[model samples]
Target: MIKKFLFSTLIALCSISAVNAQSKVKETNKLEDPDNLASQYFSQVMGVAVDATSNLKLYKFIYEWIGTPYRFGGNTQKGIDCSAFTKAIYDKVFNTTILRNSRDIFSMVNPLPKDELKEGDLVFFKIKSRSITHIGIYLGDNRFAHASSSRGVVISNLNEPYYSRYFYKGGRILDSVKDELIEE
Candidate 1:
């Protein structure tokens, strides 16, 4: 009878310790996860509650490419142009390949009114010229990320006077290309 009671007590104690250890591990994981941090950062940036799973992949790519410097014809991480940045992002995040220049990409998709823009859409600008010279990936909530000649890779509000004035049209991925853009 005494041995049975002692065994029961030992099992209860071990189970309690296991539960406590699991709780601590979970807390540690939450703190250590880069995705968790990225999600929190994006939530703060967007000023809205971001769904971690739905948008985490997109945010991860943005976070990884943040601060890449701008180069007029550059296409790699060392230095990338606005359209190249958009192309790289689409290729990496959505598994979509797009044209290298802003004009070609702008022509590929159907135009959407500003009010109709959605995440993953492309935003074009006629910066410093009459034709489409710049492009960015729309990130919802009036924010877009691009490789700015002056600022490198950065997120900016579309409502900024400079962007607003230069804004041409927003483009959704073409239906033909949609089949090519496998979700990563």
Candidate 2:
């Protein structure tokens, strides 16, 4: 009984430590300046050395994909939605898996005020309800890239009357997330 109790206590302690660490990371790392420790990773099997430049390539790739059609279950050059576009960028840039949609994505990151918005941060909107229904990548000059329903892919501004009213949350992923692409 004592051994079981000790094991349970250890597990509980570990969980608390993890939660605390996440909170601290969230507070310290701004979406604007995230750590980029992964840039030095080497793939000996492929005889390739990936570096910070990969992020730029990824960004340009996503930008080029602008105007692709929005499809329900899509992840191709042909079509994609807001969440899928964000996921595709992260997956390609950082080689990570994010939750499938906007609401789930919101919970994984920390929200920031609009003035702190940074490039690459996920911006969310509560279009239909309190739950976030849409997401986009924060591109500077107050513009964001999103897969609009009627417009396919598009760049939107926070100053836009429609988006300004629907704006709900702006989140910045912490550096310690061990995921998501962070441009160095």
Candidate 3:
């Protein structure tokens, strides 16, 4: 009788240990899923639904540079200007190179109306100047990512009073230019 009781206790302990191990494996798999983690992180950052972060590459690039400080002509994480940030995104995410200044970059695109703007499009601003002095990458839902002189790298809405006041135009890269870049 004593031997049977001891054997029964050992079996129960083993069963409990196996169950706990399985539970941990399930939790680890959930945490390791890159798509799920990216969706959750960007959704919270952009203040949008999880499904809205469908372009994981764009969002991931933006996430990595989100809080970088603004510096005129700067191009790295230590400091980056609007045009530099825009160029970086295109270079890394789209695998294309864009002009380094706002006005010149404007020439590479076909001007788009705000209502027709799409993800990965360029949004230009006159700011305090008459020319295109600032630029940002459109991120859908009226939000854009840019390196602001006052706020460093951030996402802002087109409807914001400050942005609307100086909004210049939206643009998409010309198909010819895209093709040329790809060929090179």
- Number of the predicted model whose TM-score against the real structure is largest: 3
Q: List model 3 lDDT by residue over 1-184, tens digit each.
A: 9999999999999999999999999989877788888788888877745453467888889989989999999999999999999999999999889999999999999999899998899999999898999999998889999999999999999999999999999999999899998798
Candidate 3 stretches greater than 4 Å from native: 1-33, 49-53
TM-score of each: 0.74, 0.64, 0.80
- How many residue pairs clash in model 1? 0
Candidate 2 deviates by what RMSD?
18.3
Residue 89, model 2: Cα distance from true site in angstroms? 0.8
Per-residue error for 176 in candidate 2, Å, reads 4.3
Please list all clashing residue pairs in model 3, or write none if there are none.
none
Q: C-alpha displacement of 120 in model 3, angstroms?
A: 0.8
- Model 1 gets an lDDT of 0.85
Q: What's the best-to-worst order under lDDT?
A: 3, 1, 2
Q: TM-score ranking from best to worst?
A: 3, 1, 2
Candidate 1 per-residue lDDT, tens place, 63-94, comes to 78889888899988899889888988888888
Tell me the deviation in Å of residue 84 in model 3.
0.3
Reference-based lDDT, each prediction: 0.85, 0.73, 0.92
TM-score of 2: 0.64
Judged by lDDT, which candidate is best?
A: 3
